[model samples]
Target: MKNLPQKVRSKKLSSRVDLTAMVSVSFLLIIFFMVAAELRKPKVMDLSLPYYDPKWDNIITCSIGVDNRIITVLLDDNNRIVTYSGLLFYPIESPKILSYGKNGIRKELEKRRKNILEYSASMGKPKNGPIIIIKPSKKSNFKNLVDILDEMAITKIDTYAIVNDFTPEEEKLLASK
Candidate 1:
């Protein structure tokens, strides 16, 4: 029996896992997450710009000046804002200097907002207040800017812009102050 030729037995090969489905599933999941992420963006504030009118004149301009402190300058039609009026193109009054906090700018803004609402009601027009122009000088500090913006939100005042230009009169006022 030892010298006789033995019959050869074939060995079975081990089966290998097909990873194509797993890879495809993984890719699909990655794509789904990427697309979903795009759809889940954070909400932001909505802003509506006014139509430019050549005749529209009475606009409120706020200037921020910093010289070891904060100075808030409110102007109407290039004149200072002593009172808040709903109409545009009003005459220039002496610009008022406002401090920060509850007793200062905040109070002034609240008063102005009240006046504006009242004026709008009397005029039988929508209570859309005047557009505010904000000019932040290089001397102004970050806190001052933040405070002004906060005051705007608190007063529910919209339609404001942060511009860099300063008129000659505004420059003179800053220098004098």
Candidate 2:
């Protein structure tokens, strides 16, 4: 009777495997790597950034004020207000800044580069390049800064810095010049 009348009982089980241990290991590895990795912030490795590098030690800075169409040339370590020159201005109604994007500004940038090269060469500097700092005014309205930024990006200029403050006379000088 035990061999012939034994009733079969079927037990159903789910096919999915329990991933608790695997998930625990994954989280543990993430924590391990996070703790093992360095804690310092990364620095950008390219472009016109002013570094302690002696090559750019005596670097020059220039400014384009919002009051008018004057480009100021700054000198010295203190970054003091220096002589301002140049008349590459466009009327406010039709400012020379590129519309939509920097395709137009690219050409202007080339001209500026050539002009800067000439100026640097005339000054007998080591290289004929534009290592310039652009300081646009706070009241700037033409949005030329955007185009300049786009141009800088396209030209791979990552090291450039911006100056934001200036004196009343600086504005006056910019306006008169």
Candidate 3:
């Protein structure tokens, strides 16, 4: 028998998957999420605190002047706000319990502001706004303070202070309520 030539065999090719597109897409999604998170930030409110100095303590104690423009607000428990004009001992406006909102403290603020402006102008003094002294009692919540501060901002009040110290008279007055 004559020998036959061996048949040539074809080589099989191996299948491969391209991962470049998938990697790029995953990276793009990550970047997009990061940028979105950066753009969304929490809103903040600005506060201006008084600067303290040791040397001014003596000077403050010695100074004696009646400022009718001063308004003191005391924040007590149960969302009670006690407000008065001038010194607590010699108040121009008697201490009154006021609630929150436009009809409450806001109305009083606007009325006092207008009166103060008129009084200052008539006295031949520079048109100065009312000075608010916010005294938050220990029993009061933080929200009360923030709400009052918001009121000050809404009324366009420029001069205000957040004082923690309370006199004996103020304590007794708050106790009565």
Candidate 4:
């Protein structure tokens, strides 16, 4: 009996667990988890620029200056500092007069339209930053402020400086001039 190998052949085959299907299931699960964990919400908030020197003579710009203190402006789609009518203001104050029309903002946008277009084409920047500034004395009249703002908006100046104080850097530049 021992020498005669048992001829008992099993008819039932072992259940072969196909791991390929399991692997596919695991991949699907991983993808599900990865997609579920990703964030898809849009966020919103204020995106104003950094205001340099928030405190000072409180620049109140107008279209024209009564005295010769008003800096001469040049506009050729590159330097839009002012127009003939409205005024623009930062650190918002009740202007005695305004050059930019009421509720008109983004003054610098008009002035540097040429530079902005060139820069946008070459550097991929959508708009150029205007570097114009007005340093009116604290006692400057409202009409002047109105006139300057009017000119500023017409020219398209989004960013400007109000000389409240001559920082050391400015003093050095002025002293050299």
Off by over 4 Å in 4: 1-113, 129-131, 138-140, 161-163, 168-177
Whole-model lDDT, model 1: 0.56
Best by lDDT: 3
Candidates' C-alpha lDDT: 0.56, 0.47, 0.85, 0.42
Candidate 2 has what TM-score? Answer: 0.33
On residues 1-177, what C-alpha lDDT tens digit does candidate 1 reach at each position? 479888898998879889999999999999999989988988676344334444546543322111101123443222222222222223233356656678876787676557556655665545546455666666776666676788789878875677778767566666665
How far residue 12's Cα lies from its native spot in candidate 4, in Å, is 62
Instruction: List CA RMSD, all candidates.
Output: 9.4, 12.2, 9.6, 14.8
lDDT of 1 at 152: 81
In terms of TM-score, which candidate is stronger, 3 or 4? 3
TM-score for candidate 3, please give it.
Answer: 0.63
Candidate 4: 10-residue stretch with minimal lDDT:
63-72
How many residue pairs clash in each candidate at the backbone level?
4, 2, 0, 40
Off by over 4 Å in 3: 1-66
Candidate 1 clashes: the total is: 4
